[model samples]
Target chain A: MALKPLGDRIVIKQVEKEETTKSGIVLPGTAQEKPQIAEVIAVGPGGIVDGKEVKMEVKPGDRVIYSKYAGTEVKYDGEEYIIIKQSDVLAVIE
Target chain B: MALKPLGDRIVIKQVEKEETTKSGIVLPGTAQEKPQIAEVIAVGPGGIVDGKEVKMEVKPGDRVIYSKYAGTEVKYDGEEYIIIKQSDVLAVIE
Candidate 1:
């Protein structure tokens, strides 16, 4: 099943953290906080403003950096997906 | 000191949770996660869209609901505030 966001909503899939630390130390899930990094998977069409459409700056393939705590996490089809507005995105990664 | 948001940025002050629960239970900080509720304190003038300015729908006095994990938390002048884009706002409380 595909989830479609309304307005300027975006769907992102979080990047899983590495199981082993840089020093080759295995870390458990409860060791520390979960990583919040994510990859943009889909975006809604441009948002409507004053009878006009505002195009988005980021695209589907763009890797964006957003607020670590900025989005609603939802489990769809047994996969975790985050729904955030375009404005929540802080920067685009090259 | 006042925080001025640039472009579509918005400044919000988180609402502190009550110390005592409804049943008069004093919960510790570690007992549960912190409440993510916030109140909009200030908003940017407007957002630039397609060479035009799109006026914001929300205002300073409006209570807005946003993603639980959305926005960067910043501490300024001994106070905590969140800087998020207007698009991060999901709904307005009437």
Candidate 2:
């Protein structure tokens, strides 16, 4: 199922948390902290300001990094999604 | 001292975390989670997109709510500031 964000909101599918520590120790899901990486799945049209529409810079299919605790978590189609404003996105992965 | 943000960036001064709980219980600083509220102090001159500039909808002095972990923290003049994108702002207080 595809979900579209309204005005300037972006929906992101979180990348699974790393299962292993840098030392190669595996961590169970219950022990994992919040995931900070995501894949952009949908984007909203630019937000309106003073009667002018602003367009977004990022697009769907982009890999992005966001703050671990940023965004509102929502469940859709049994999958977890994060809804955030375009500005909440820290950077687009190159 | 005041700071100016570049294009599409906003500088926010964190609103001190609630010192007491709703039930009148006081929580210590170490027990406090991250702060999610802030006041807008500076705003960037909208981001450049396709060579056109997008003006920001928020301005200085607006009370805003942002994701708890949404911004880059910086310190200047003994004050902490968070720099975020306009999109990261969840809402503006009237």
Tens digits of per-residue lDDT, candidate 1, A3-75, equal 4554576778765556223324332333233334467877766668444675778777676666644456544
lDDT of 2 by residue, B32-91 (tens): 223255689998888674465566878799866455545798999989999987766655
Where model 1 places Cα greater than 4 Å from the true spot, the runs are A1-94, B19-35, B49-53, B68-70
Question: Cα deviation of B14 in candidate 2 (Å)?
Answer: 0.8
Docking class of 2: incorrect
Please give the RMSD to the true structure for each candidate, in Å.
11.2, 11.0
Q: What is the lDDT of residue A50 in candidate 1?
A: 40
Tell me how far the alpha carbon of residue A69 in candidate 1 is from the true structure, in angstroms, after superposition.
17
Best by lDDT: 2
- Which residue segments of model 2 deviate by more than 4 Å? A1-94, B19-35, B47-52, B68-70
Which predicted model would earn the best TM-score?
2
Clashing pairs in 2: A87-B87
For each prediction in turn, the share of the native Cα contacts (below 8 Å between chains A and B) that it retains comes to 0.02, 0.00
TM-score of chain B of each: 0.69, 0.72
